[model samples]
Target: MAETDVISIDAAQQLATAALIANRTAPDIAARVASALVASEAAGQPGHGLSRVPSYSAQAQSGKVDGFARPSLERVTGSLVRVDGAFGFAYPALDLALDALPEMARGNGIAMAAVRRSHHFGQGGLHCERLADQGLVALVFGNAPKSIAPWGAKEPLFGTNPIAFAAPVPGSASLVIDLAVSRVAKGKIMAAEKAGRPIPEGWALDRDGNPTTDAAAAMEGTMLPIGDAKGAALAMMVEVMAAALVGSSFGFEASGLFSGEGDPPNLGQTIIAIDPGLSSGGTYGERIAALMTAMAGAEGARLPGSRRIGARLKAEREGMEVPRLILDEVRKLAGGQSLSRLD
Candidate 1:
């Protein structure tokens, strides 16, 4: 087995900074992007963390992801809006959508925004949590390039298609549920491949349609859904709402994020925010607080989002620990000094 090395969060941040600089991303955008990646690591979602830096930088340098593209918004109604990401980083586009959500939800009791032509937005739960922080309930969904296969099929048909929900709990932490509908995300396959390790069986199939533990072969095949057909059905729903609903690419029609050529991936995301107080007659906050108290009061009962919140708090207080191999790759991609020198 290969050895694992851990490094502090500051080193991870510096590596991401170097990658962004090498990719020609602006300092402000680079910092925000780096923060998101590090936060993913802090939250224990390494698949979405700094491991993605090299690929992201390569995309930016190859012009597959424009570093300077700014998103433009089109407000359709008091509660409905659309944003064109203009091929920029999805983080900025999601930030713009969150910024507009409060006023829209306050005005109409609910707000929905469709994002088109965006890149990967990291953890969907983070987007929902941002709205929950403002005392609103949020649902977020996104569609990516094809990786998972439809039921009874051997070829890839849909992206992992993640969905997230968050609701404010008044005096306590927000309740958040975020998950990819597939058995696992494609990034995990990539991670396993990077580590030259075999993935668990049932995670994916080989090119010949046989279930395999080989990460590289699985990448050539298709990913399985979480609950057989159910997850695939949910993925289709998300694809319609996030991609078709937003007038963006869907399924195999979507550009490959790893191709590094052709048109941008043009991924799509949907965000919905609701002001519960408007419908609950001022009792929504109290109700949520009561439920949270009851759940926490129960023996061995932990609330949703608590784990990530606790992890984030610990990371904030004592700093995050990241895998040194990921850092080394980032440095090499950024043209910085090699890890051998530090060793």
Candidate 2:
């Protein structure tokens, strides 16, 4: 393991608070946003951890991301809703969708929501897990700036385009699955680049269209999808649902969330919530729980959400481990000092 420096969650929150305050964001917004990031790290997703704080702070300060923006909702039908993120981070808008989904699902047996003009949301699975915890099954899809190449093509044409699903399970954490359609996430590439490490073979192609492990070159090139054509096809489906269906920017047309572009990324996300009871005649939870029990009873099969939930519990009890470089950067940013590390 790398030499990990552990810090209490409170310390992480304090650092996030200081950084956001230094950037002039409202205290409440700062705390909420910081808590999200901290929660991601505590849940073992370092790709969406403190590494993103500086970028978020910069985006807020530069007006690319509106710290005070609130989502506006429009009911398209009894079972469908549309949300405008108002050029803000995706969490708040997604929260709105979650709030509306239960009532809509109860009324209609299913609910669907589409959101546009949002920023990067760390993990779609988190949202689905929340719904699953509330006795609903959920599927979510999100699209971002183009970073992946289509099958047999060299240039980038689609974003990583993540999809997530969650279902309720008794006596265990919800069964949640979240993965990038690409072989790896762009954030993973960025992390490898920052650590001066080579990515694995098959994850990306070089600018010249040859496979490469060099993170910097891979960033300049394109990512291949998992399972070759199958994953690419899934990514295309996500693009259609999250971008085309929502009338939002698609692929390369979307603004880069991390590049500090003045324009909003014009991100799009789609969520589907289903009240299982409506389908299973009120025994939905018990049936789903029984299914999970049977699956877990199989040899060597662990629950879907076990790893992440375990990571979160461990972090809560033992604190989270952050990289030294990230810690130093956060300290510098929080202290109102510029650092050469990011440069």
- Model 1 poorest 10 in a row by lDDT: 334-343
lDDT of 2 by residue, 1-343 (tens): 2345788888888887678667756666667778788887888877777878777888888888888787889999999999999987788888889999999998899999999888787777888998988989999999978888787777788899999999877666788998999988787776566556788999888889888999889888888899988988988999999998887888788877665656878889999999898978899778876787698689988766578988998998999988777777677778852222211
If scored against the real structure, what TM-score would every candidate get?
Answer: 0.92, 0.92
Give me the runs in candidate 1 sitting further than 4 Å from their true place.
297-302, 336-343
lDDT of each: 0.83, 0.82
Evaluate residue 169 in candidate 2 and report its C-alpha lDDT on the 0 to 100 scale.
Answer: 73
List, residue by residue over 12-66, the lDDT tens digit for candidate 1.
7766866776676766677778878888878877778887887788788888898
Global fold similarity of model 1 (TM-score): 0.92
**Can you give the lDDT of residue 119 in candidate 1?**
91
